[model samples]
Target: MEMNGSNSNLQSDNKQEAVKNPGDETSGSTAQDESWMKLVNLQLLSNELECLICSSLIFDPLTLPCGHSFCRICLTRAFDFALKCPTCRAAVYMDPLSHPTSVALKALTQQLFPE
Candidate 1:
């Protein structure tokens, strides 16, 4: 299948947007607004890290061929019912081991929620 460069570009844009210059001056309201935005972004990111099947933060993320990711255990359990993707109902031919863990996603989740 053709690669989608747009996803990479969007990820880079999000990385840029997440960074800020602490030295930059801002009014009280502006600072508060920035804080609120940061909180909203954090929540959105947390939601993205959550596994649909388990309804918890993904421990070992595994991205299916359909481009949907889920916790490894959750996906494995799902496979017992049907060899189909939980999100899109796409047919899954290979075993769960064939799908590699998303290292970057796992590290990001660990870093963000160290507790």
Candidate 2:
């Protein structure tokens, strides 16, 4: 199977478009809506970006042939003995650490969780 590039459940930030309520003040309502949406979106992002091994936000993300994403450090530790994916049981190479960082995922995660 072909190893695909980064995939994210959060998808895109541009999709957030606030609906204007009839007779509502555009300035105040829009601002409040934006703040609310941001908080909600951040929460959605936090759920999707966790590393399976660490059970926290991912850093130095790496994508494996099985299409699983994980922290590079986590993958290193998990692959210490087995040459397979921990989640799917798909066989991976022993030296999976040599793979390049998942640049698209790294950028997306950093953008959402920049604290």
Candidate 3:
């Protein structure tokens, strides 16, 4: 009976030691997983900031003849004075009613500003 009690006590001590160990592999893996998740979340958030006009993410976006971006419809609406580039104020042919939204920009906008 005495021998059995001693063995049981040793097993309990081992369990406690295992619990106290800070360098356990399970804890290390959990920490790494958390870091990875944070990185993924940041990456996902970076997809926002799409231009409202083109409905796409702005990439090498040019300023329109109206001092607005080609992606913004406000520039296109100013074509009544003459078809002109919004940013440069240069004379150019543009159909005010033909403004089209960029699909890529739309997707990026949705990602950045969901709903």
Candidate 4:
């Protein structure tokens, strides 16, 4: 009888271990996958929000006539050198410092990256 009880206990322990181990591994894998996806998405967003000249998050974004957007400070500095679109090389006659900020884009960027 004692032999049978010991065998049953061992079998139950093995069954619990089997179930617990797989669950642990699966949950760990799922967590890792979620974190990886979040990091990839953040990198993509960062790339989109990055200033072409400074390669940093665009602050005080300015939209040009050619529909390209860049940070006002970066564009102002570039215009100081030569008043032309950095992305397209189109002639920019207007003063970059007097250009208005792209309101929708600025709001979106601020909401997404407040820091």
Best by lDDT: 4
Clashes of 3: 16
Listed in order, each prediction's TM-score against the native is 0.70, 0.67, 0.34, 0.68
* Alpha-carbon shift of residue 14 in model 2 (angstroms): 29
Clashing pairs in 4: none
Arrange candidates, best TM-score first.
1, 4, 2, 3
Residue range 7-89, candidate 1, lDDT tens digits: 78877775555454444442223667779989999899999999999999988899888888999989999999999999999
What digit string (tens of lDDT, one per residue) describes model 3 on residues 1-115?
9999999998888767766874676333476777998888766654335444454555433444454444444544456555666446577655544545545555655665475
Runs in model 3 deviating more than 4 A are 1-72
Off-target runs (Cα >4 Å) in candidate 1 are 1-29
Report, for every candidate in turn, its global Cα lDDT versus the true structure.
Answer: 0.84, 0.78, 0.56, 0.87
Steric clash count of candidate 4? 0
Query: For model 2, how does the per-residue alpha-carbon lDDT over 35-108 read when each residue is reduced to its tens digit?
Result: 99899988888878888889899899998888888999999999887878978989987465678998999999
Model 4, range 43-75, lDDT digits (tens) per residue?
Answer: 899899888999989999999999889999999
Per-residue error at 79 for model 2, in Å?
0.6
TM-score (C-alpha, index-matched) for candidate 3: 0.34
Among all windows of 10 consecutive residues in model 1, the one with the lowest summed lDDT is 20-29
